[model samples]
Target: MKKSILLFTTMFCLSLVVFAQQNKEQDESSDTVKTIEKLKYKQQPGLALAASKIFFSDKRYSISGFGEFNFIPVQNNVNPEMGDLELYYSSLYRYATFFGYRLTDKLIWNSEFQIEFLHYKTEESHYEIVIEAFFDYLFKDYLKARVGFYPLTIGYVNNNDEPVMFYSVNRSEVERLIIPSTWIEFGTMFYGNLSPSWSYALGFSQGLNSQKYISGTWIRQGREIRFDLPKSISINPQLNYTGVKNLTLSTSGYYGNSGQGEFIEISGEPVEVKGKINLTSAYAKYDWKNFRFVTVGTYGQLGDTEKLFELTKDENGENGQVLGKEVYGYLMEVGVDILPYLRKGRPIHEKQNFLFDTHEMKLSLFSRFERLNTHNKIEQSLEGLPRVESDMEIWTVGLNFNSRENIVFKANYQHRLNKFNGDQFPRKNIVETGIGFIF
Candidate 1:
């Protein structure tokens, strides 16, 4: 451990030296206003370099972050028979910072730290987390190696989670429930470009633990991302194509055993039950003039659910907590930026690669529809319970405005629908507003 610490310190110091040298070069270039080309960002990893330009104009290593808060001023359950009405919720939800360094032309370090739900009443505190901390070595244009804790590169949000990247006050429900966006793991990965417009990644990591699997949320509770060593091993692979103008197509998958390093008591005796998860997703995104469209479809299957459900029924003593054999999700969205058509606006000036314009504004009107079911299939029937606790369909209409790329203000109306004909559960309607900034 001591040797590891010393090596890290030395590399960090050397990175500072590289930054100083780059700054000197920038000073000598044309500098009424520094553009991206003046300071060398191409030496960093691909996505990290893009995000850095949005977070900082010139300071890449200094602390920079994005924070967003939301408010729900109106909420109601269309039917009163479900239960007592919920007041909805609000908070200073997410504050995340980037600490990235370019150690050398062939190496880089990237990390993100975050705070969630910043609210207190003298007895409660928020949650702190390390979203990602990893190192990458660039050996060639088509291949690179990475190790450390990294988020699974399964979807767009999991890869580019900055607030400015999405128009919703919150992220997509499909991404949250089905894909479990921001899912991180400790592992080694190899990723790189196949061509100027194609990229791919393949990695193996610590897998989920079926011991924690619950009914309504499927494998979400089984992530084992906290203080536990999951014994199972998992692999995720992805391929993406961006050859068409303003269009992107991608496919990704995850396969892993969901059981490891744990035991469950069944019939007053200890037994080891095994399970595994198989998931796949397809995505297509397009832009035509000022209009944007996106759609995604995902399906997943779990093996050995009968044994897992019996264990869940014993531990939780609730049929609603039964295990699921399958889960799936679907999503579609369309939006248009009306600002450019309303008037002629100055595009943010760039020098080949710099993404900065302090005052350029954007306004978009968008709508999204999602349908998901965690318990789409089960091996055994619950003797007494609601059909499924996690069956849900949601749609929302919203308007998002950006004073600049780094600052956003938004308002939206959302309505949720469930199965069971009409009102076995509540159909909730809500109005919300939000503000987010990056610095």
Candidate 2:
């Protein structure tokens, strides 16, 4: 079944590409529509697109953002040794607001601050935090530059992580683990569209803190946020193609040194290691006839792990963990707007008007599968590292109800299987529901 699904996805993608080129003129014209809901950023992510109204209207300043709330009824969760307890039953995941302004026709400034608690830890009280603040200087659709803090576009969620943008109540596991969405850094980016068919982004930003590396998550634990950006830098680059109607394909890459001036004791000697990270990913999304298909594949490499693992060692160096030299994962899902199939009236595709222009409610069903191994390949398993691969596999089935263009309610059941000790261990399950909205 997995093989069949993979084959179908491949064929589906090829078919879309061929059809898009065959009818390029129609798809190309769709780019010029600067409707209040569909203004063009050419090179910005969905968060930027969220301000379409501000960009299209005569107003010079506006406020916008998104909020997500969720409730989880049951979750067996990770293994006991992993020491992860389930968050409480319910919580307001995030309340972020975006502040946008048009400095001039040629320049734009956008900023964002969010109030959020880590899972159900609202008792700790998170302060209002600045998630993003940037100045965009647009010379044309073909050339642009941005300065200050921003996030990368290495994967779908990294670009469009709003609650309503995806079918699942939580972000996909593969994206969260391997690609790590909401991964932001203080940086400078140059981006623009070569044409209506092609867009690209290049960013140089603060690097990670290598000392924080750990097993099971690789470099995901190394991300940091600070008022003073570090000197070590990471570079991220992306290229996108949207020549097909309702179809987008992109490939993005990241490479950087994660040392951040931290020194670790390797062999009883202090050493400043340039623990580098290299990652690349390919993503695709297509919507047609009330059906949407999404897929992403990512591969990554970590440098100086042997020494970095030395940093992760306990004071006695007895139970130190392992970090993989390489890691990879992929995810795939399809969603169908079943409301159209269930209706007694006209078929959505046959309607004379644009399918997306409709304000009617929609009910959708979706299922997704993901496989990842943060410790996929490593030399002789020593300490806590496994001799055989330690990997995770997940399956999720969900429903989404869109009552309006920007509001969504969703629920999903997720099951997890983890492989280690030459055995497959069932890692509980997660059942959750949530609501998401944008303004």
Candidate 3:
């Protein structure tokens, strides 16, 4: 742990020197004023990097990567008898490399190769592979088309998973458990701007695999080319409005049939099941001065659960066949950039106070609260089925220190507010720290 901290500090200091040098060079250049003005309204480099692959760009091709390292130095259990203070390295969260080519002014090709290392409680570790390859064509300002494997446009976190884009050391529990961050699938989509402040996206994609859909964690069903092929199809649509200054409001939904023409033998007879899934969500974000706030709510439902249960009963056994008919979750967060108060000076340029700007150093203190219920409702007919009480509430307080728009250091304390299924579960409070960078 000490070694890690030392390494992080050294790199952080070096990054500051490099940033200072870059800024100094910019100041010496003739375009200093223009550059500063552009930075004032520009989004973080992290977002720009992600979008550059599919959107308009002058360069013929480019390469970029992002990575994050996390550690948990302290974990206090509520029950003394349960365990002592625990400490360990959390995981090498994400290592992703991207390749993008601009075939023409209106055509682009992009691909991403990513690997994530996850550690389990039993001192075991494994790696997961993620890939996103897609092609996009610009038809006009109001219409465009994209096809191939891409991240699902379900919520804010999935598309914006870059470490520098969020204030918390870890993503929200609701997004992880309910919305399923990093969810990706093969699909074709059409998106366009409706007006200066409004936009929309619609897509059709391969649907979930019911065999993998377990209990309240519906997102686990995302089939990423693991099976021979998926028979189900999903339709998703989203709308966004940014008409209000410093505010963004958006909503998205997903509907799909998960069964994919699969059949199972029940009571010595062949039975076909069509498990349908539906999800809807709405969210809003607002920025006022140095303060930022966001709220999101989502509801999900699965159809033919009773049949799905019977079909999987033999293969998964009785204990593993619990699939929720309904699920829901919500999250709320607020943050303040305290660095402006600590530094005694005016911004470098006008429009520098825009919430999305990331050219300057930022120090933020944030808090988030969330609730998730994987099995909010179940079919009454599925009697004798053991239901796992997958309901949870969580609170997190954190600090984010960004040396530059693409490099960040984070620390946070998280508390689990609700116990799972009574005294059998242990409640743990965790202290987490991490460093993230992109280039």
For each predicted model, how many residue pairs clash, with residues at least 3 apart or on different chains? 0, 0, 0
Model 3 agreement with the true structure over 1-439: per-residue lDDT tens digits:
3443354456445534433443442444445431111122133211335434334334577555566777664223333222111112244456676677888888888888876665434344555688888888878868988888877777777767878767787777677667877678788888888999998889899887786665545546445654356676799898989999999898998899888787877788888878888888888989999999999899988888887876555444664455668888999999998988876576544332222234567899999998888777778876355543447787899999876666778999888755455332223567889888654
lDDT per residue for candidate 1 within 1-439, as digits (tens), equals 2332343345434433433342343344555433222222331232433334422334334444566666554223333222212212333366665666767766667787765553222223344355667787879869998887877768666665667667788777678667877577788788889998998889888887676665545776666454456577789999989899989898998898877755567688877766778989878899999898999889999887766765555435654245557888998999998888776775644322112243457799999998987777767554244433457788889998877555678888878766634233433566778876554
Best by TM-score: 3
Q: Estimate the lDDT of model 2.
A: 0.69
- TM-scores of the models, in the given order? 0.78, 0.80, 0.81
Model 1 per-residue lDDT at 203: 85
- On lDDT, the stronger of 1 and 3 is 3
Arrange candidates by TM-score, descending.
Answer: 3, 2, 1
TM-score of candidate 3 against the unseen true structure = 0.81
Ranking by lDDT: 2, 3, 1
Flag the better candidate by lDDT, 1 or 2. 2
Residue 171, candidate 1: C-alpha displacement in angstroms: 1.1
- Off by more than 4 A, model 3: 1-56, 73-89, 226-229, 310-318, 345-359, 381-388, 422-427
Give the total clashing residue pairs for model 2: 0
Model 1 C-alpha RMSD vs. true structure (Å) is: 8.1
* Per-residue accuracy of model 2 over 291-381 as CA lDDT, tens digit each: 9999999999988777776666677974454677789999999999988778758654432222132445789999999988877767454
